[model samples]
Target: GTPDAEEPTVTAWGLEGSSLRPGQPSPALEDWEEASEWTSWFNVDHPGGDGDFESLAAIRFYYGPARVCPRPLALEARTTDWALPSDVGERVHLNPTRVFWCLNREQPRGRSCSNYHVRFRCPLEATWGSWGPWGPCSGSCGPGRRLRRRRCPSPAGDACPGRPSEAQKCVRPRCPGCGPNTCGCPDHILLGSVVTPSGHPLPGARVSLRDWPGTVATSDAHGTFRMPGVCASSRANVSAQMDGFSAGMAQAQANSSMSAVATVVLNKLEKPYLVKHPESRVREAGQNVTFCCKASGTPMPKKYSWFHNGTLLDRRTHRYGAHLELHGLRPDQAGTYHCKAWNDAGAVRSGTARLTVLAPGQPACDPRPQEHLIKLPDDCGQPGRGPTYLDVGLCPDTLCPSPAGSSPRCGDAGSRCCSVSRLESRKVHCSGYTLPVKIVAECGCQKCLPLRGLIRGRVVAADSSEPLRFARILLGREPIGFTSYQGDFTLEVAPSTQRLVMTFVDPSGQFVDTVRVLPFDPRGAGVYHEVKAMRKKAPIILDARQSNTISLGEMGEEAPLAAGIIPPGAFRSADGQPYTGAVEAQV
Candidate 1:
């Protein structure tokens, strides 16, 4: 069979130049040449005999130019040859320029041959022919390495591929970081990547991050937040809530380093409501009063109504506003008032207020008068001029009729009849009445009236017959006059009368004696005298000069004059002088 095409193979090898400086490592090589045949000592026909390699030497050989070398050589190969081929070369020569070596051996004719018939194969191995300052090397190296390439340093200044240093991978935060107990951002905000429980980014959700002692922050649209100048030692707590979403919370530690992201979720909640009334009580008699109803609910009250006395009042009065104003009050309006507030959920009523009203003026009679009677003075003994008895009577008018069957009569006596008479005489029956009578005597030509009388007399003491000074002489019930130094008294009578009774009374109101008299005398210029009878125990008046002249006309008895009494200015018996004897008296 023709030679099978060489199986595809790859090899890695390195070569050093001869001119390389001391302590300098060589670079890795890129290319190589393939060997056709080789001979090995163990497979030789003579043991340990030098064989001729003329066929290998006479074969066409591709070679590279020689150059100065630095360190050593290394080669790595892979082949598809199943059994060793017989046409391989015995020895190989390395070339610096081409990065490959040629194999050579001696032939049987004791001369170099270009070809060999037996297969001789050897396993590939790297070769190092030189040494560097640190160690032997076969390829180029990275910066900061020893010429021998024994040890390499990492960017972090440690052994290559070891643990990183603090300057290499350790990172801290410029601002406050989040933690389990505090919000990483200022004003309780969440920072960095965050998600809800359902793994959706919460946009426009009010997320709050809080630190201890009431510091808080909010999250932005990116679900990231930061807090400036926050306490690094405080714990971070994050929360989020939105409409139609469940509320959620998360916690983190606020260390100087970066914090982990927190997740939040929100749930639904209920709202509270209230119904209130402003007034407490109402009065009877309905008044135009106002009622205020205040309602607070998640959804506000939609309707309001007022009730009075268990009946619904006019709905228009409640202005669909805060307060209800009622105009025009009435008595029927008095009742308990209350308000009701209603919404979609339900209705509520306020407490009742009681109301009241009042009523308006109403008529009445006069008082009666009492009856009384009074007596008039006895001195009023005249026919028409003297006072009359007071006939007390009850009349609507003071000018009403009297008891004497006359107009303007006494008010008390009504129509009763009465009578009056002379002093000390029997009372005569008359159609009208007179008051009690008072008697008086007149001394001059004028006849004496009972109350309006003028009487003249000389008053003397009964025992000594001497004129009394300042002696009081009373006529009837009234004191008429007083006695002068001459013991004389002149008094006017109240009424006109003929037969009179007189009494001598002293200042002490003592009565000496009562003498009756007629004022007119029929005799001519002869004084008539009347005397009181003297008692035996009283002194006898024997001296005629001491005797007082008492007029006999004032006497009460109807008696004849004494025998020698004469009338003044009349012929007495046949003599020319007036008569000194008793004259013929006319009846």
Candidate 2:
């Protein structure tokens, strides 16, 4: 048999190995989903039939219009044995439009093209993911902005149609105005905090100026306060008082921002406590990751430090703070991480979290496929051996890896599947002959496409049973196909389509136009229907001076329900012109 013809060379996909960039991935991949779409794996061609040519034009010839997207973003190809083209080294041609590999076309004499399948990735649309948690404030004081972001629709992590992040003004209810003369506090504004004797946050406490009795500010839930408009002698003598404890006083060190630690501890001493801790993660090399932790205390623990595997992580390099962010992670970066919070009262360390990093070419999934048994033809089995069954072997339906790697997007990471990475051809003994069958030799991970559903039938006239040759066929208002000379037609039904509505028009005008609603399987099964059309009535001469009746048309043996009748002197021209020499009527 001849080889499968190649697709247009506008974009040739090189054999993917270590550089198989992906467009979509699995659940453990990204936190957000993509707006892009994918077609299910399709195996329209078999090795036994013309050596398995999975060309785009050939596929479109078999499956009709709209089965494939007009413009695809990416293409994936793999053999039935779940082997990638990169892993197998097949002389295959791949693009967004087609995936072609002919049996032994350019390989050794014994080599052949495996049964293959393919899928396409469509262009990104306007889909979006859920909004993420809000981030830390941009400023360390009041009226600063905090931001939260949402995920856009592309597997390639492309920017969305508009701004991906949303911002809102946020005022710190806790620890307001970190430094004096900052956060719009120019007049030596005093900032202080009130905490319980045991280091717990004192929600509602009052702090007032020593000289101005009415000039007071309440401590917020985070046990912090900020007050302005009081500039006397380079200091602010403020007193803190909570309902359960006695009054405590502290003088603000307004002249020095570094020494401006104005906190009124009810019992004089407090210990730091953990509020948030870092989380463990697994990532691939050359990717970015972040770890975060938080703490609270009497003096509001202002110092945060991070450690990796007992070694202190650099503050300037990793940006270690309440949040520690790492970029372009390498395999050497994998280790246990912890954070420490410190204040004058005491110091406390957070629980440790682990980080796992993988190399780019490493397989995250097992390369072996599971066992799958298939039954052969009835006559192929022995009389007492019951129905013949063979272990064809199959990979699980779950997501797997591919040489063309999966995108680390929201849907599925490594969008490849566990499939036949290896297979063998065999001949089984029948009663009088042998039947050739392909059995799974081995299975691994390969990308696959979904199948396209089909609808087929023939069109003919109701009276003479003649084929409705070359009639135009339309799905809705869009013309999709035409009947063959034998009146045979085929239609491909997309998975997203809910119903099939088609209109058939005869070019000869001898038959009336026909419209029908068809039923089909959404999961890529085939359906058939026979359409019957009615012939138009022939013209006949009529008398305008006497009563006359005319019959319209009929279907099968049913009575003709359409007709017209006229009495004498009823004939008249549409305009003021006289009637024609002969009155001709057709219904």
Candidate 3:
């Protein structure tokens, strides 16, 4: 089969938006033949003072003698703008084994070879050249990747069967106490941070050098710590410890040129603690009953074992977890049931709950409400001994029948909750007058949404009393509502919310973005919080001198030429507030 007329992968080199550079090459002026091996880009002369004279001997003289091919397979010649030798419209010479030169005298008056560079492609050995030496480790310390390369001998042939480039894991020798080339040296300061598993900064963590005693530091509220004279561009083993977390260690990356920063991640730990436990349930013999148990711990409990009358139940047959659903309950299955939660730290056994299964056609719930007592506030207490107590009454969570096609589905289908069906408003006579209280008078099953309480607040400027009106209210990142014109806002808190996280964004940019984590009451009770928003932009200092005029790099710097002038205060912090902290001017 004939070889594919593969075009040489010509890479454009030099300045952007420019037609010519000192010795830059054009992308399109290279040879179209497939390349077996290519010498590094060689340029022996510049397009200044005289015409560029890039001879083969000159390239070998400046570079190593083995850098150039004695006899070449193909040659490429180009101007910086991709103009080929034919299109250059100037007298020049490009010999594959000799030299690529251009004389100003030979070019048309006031013209030259557009600044040139050359490349040579040569035939190869069997399939590929021997693999080159492995490159330096990508990372200064610890594990990283290293690369080595080999060249296909014949680009015209089927790609030498395998990859031309290869990579492997690079392992640097671990340093005990800042040893040889393994560590970068001369760095002055070492900076590190301790964070929770969720990446939140964990303040108050004590950080100390692994082997250096008395060298201790503490993370601030931002979870960051600094150590001076730590690493001379050397690797430093650092560890962090806190009260309720596993000790975490990290290799601090430090070197001569910059301040070294490392992050130590701490895993919060706690013994298995039960948050929700199984409760006693009464159900008809043929009905289903479900008991749920939840445990909270670091590395959340994933293993739960249920027991029946002190006997461990077969997990393979039951296949239940935190929630155990028993279908077609039998009298024998009715007994004290409990669950044991296990985590890496420890295991906890939940309190036992009784499962009473009655015969068919039996009522599972009592119609009468239990007498529940409540404590009145200290100011509303009796003048005598203990605080006055009132019988507010209570409704148990028992199974009850549902009404005909009405209210929300209570518990599960065909089942309901024994909830407060009626409430009686009474007065508790106190020192001054009386405090009105609602007492549970009846218990029945209906629907259950249980109206949630409201979260009300007013967003206003922190420094000034100006209201932050019409700000978007985001609940768990979803748009829930907007503040009114008076900056007052209210929304019903979700029933399952333990932490109410909200973000208020000001579309008008008058206020910095505000994020708040509010305390929540699991019971249906309204919570009030005042939100103070910091004003956004601030007046910044500037250098108004004429010497501070920006020169916009007619000199060819990639950055804007505003070196002498104070930069505009257009920069913002990560939270979208006007940045007022320390900033590096060089950046």
Candidate 4:
């Protein structure tokens, strides 16, 4: 068949093929000759298209040929419809159906070049088309190409993501907000910030401390504050607020930090409340005593007033937990005491406590009596032969009663008589008795003779010039005489031719020796016979004719007088005759 001399008409059409099944072919022009060679081209209208067949079918019509030629070549041209497998496409399908043309070409003639162009269209609605034109194609011969477009869905799920699984809704821990609150800081810390009621933060809230006797601290900008070295177990009230926000309060724990946060809400400032401590027991006198009154309130106590028996006490006393101490208490200071705790908001009084005191007992006293005696001896020369015994007594003056009756007495006579003549309440006195005298028979002898004259003198204290008293005066072979309290004494002896010694003992027991008396001649007679010289060592002896006013100064340095001797001219025999040569001595 000759090639179609007349200009050939080419018409293109699109066919819809079921993806599930195949359909029969139809013949539209019997008299026309089918083209032996045709080329297939792909059109991609959209870059990103839905995977539905509407986009795949829209380009089918542009793949068909319109008219046939008079000469048929050995090449075959046919259209086949087949469903593309769902899994065979990429994320998106560019072309659902594929078309191809096999053709024969003659060798090159003297110099002729043939060129043909094919067009393609989508079969579905305009909105349904390939993503865009297929990629670059080869020249001349039919080009077969596979096109695919990726499908990317809008990011799935909600825009904002749900919270993480590990997240939790937790409320912050808080402190018990209140002043003088018993809940205090733990062992080694102070009160930090107090959080809001809803766990919000409040900064710069003042937190006054009420450590009983004193107020210690306030909150700072971070709602954190501290009182250094304050006693633990102290109570506190915490409140916080800003200018525009309502105030709130919470009883917060003290000593809370980052690891131990305290949530404290501050309430609006209000009138303070007061709590009173119980009454204390009475204390003993002379003991250190402490009385405590524990109280609590808002705004913290301003001052602690102490009282004893309704009188105010100095508030400077050392205190603990509202306690007032009385150092070294005395019995006179015992009484009822009370205390009042006050702040700007309010005040409270504690119960009364009574204190009793006792006095110490008195000391004991014991009594006893004492006594002594002074007595004169009966014989001056022989103290051992004097009164053997003397009476003594002691009477009570202040402590005890006096003994009844006179004090017992004793003497040389061996008599049990009450020698004390006068018996006063605190004094006693007694007199010594002498032996009785006895008469003797007369002897056959001449009548007795009288002794010669005697001499005497007085002795006195050399230093005091006072007369010596109770002094012993002795003459040889004669009885000893005692000087009177005035120091006067006397001795008698017969005139004889014997040496005489006169001795005088002063009250101080000193011996004074007089000059020796020489024998006197009875026949010799003189008005004043100075027979013996008064010695400086003895009492002064004056002549019998001289007055007895003999002074110690009159005695000169002469030998002591001997006993039983007489002064001259001071004696005569008992008979009228003066013819005595010797005479027996007499005392």
Question: Per-residue alpha-carbon lDDT of model 4 for 51-148, expressed as tens digits?
Answer: 12222122322222222222222111122223222212112111122321111222123321111122222221112222443333222222123343
TM-score-based ranking, best first? 3, 2, 4, 1
lDDT of 4 at 193: 59
Query: Could you give candidate 3's per-residue lDDT for residues 294-351 as a string of tens digits?
Result: 8777757999998877867767557788888777667767889999999868899988
Q: Estimate each model's TM-score.
A: 0.17, 0.30, 0.33, 0.19
lDDT of 4: 0.37
Candidate 1 residue-wise lDDT at 393? 30
Residue 157 CA displacement from its true place in model 4, Å: 89
* Candidate No. with top lDDT: 3
Q: How many backbone collisions does model 2 have?
A: 18
| Clash count list over all predictions | 116, 18, 5, 67
lDDT of each: 0.37, 0.66, 0.68, 0.37
Worst 10 residues of 2 by lDDT: 23-32
Off by over 4 Å in 2: 1-371, 376-388, 396-418, 424-445, 519-529, 540-586
TM-score, model 2 to reference? 0.30
Given candidate 3, what's the lDDT at residue 39?
A: 60
Highest-scoring model, TM-score? 3
**lDDT value for model 3:** 0.68
- Tens-digit lDDT track of model 2 for 453-554: 899999999878899999999976579999999999998886545457788999998888999998989778899999998888887898777777887566
The local lDDT score (0 to 100) that residue 288 gets in candidate 2 is 62
Better of 1 and 2 by lDDT: 2
Name the candidate, 3 or 4, with the larger TM-score value: 3
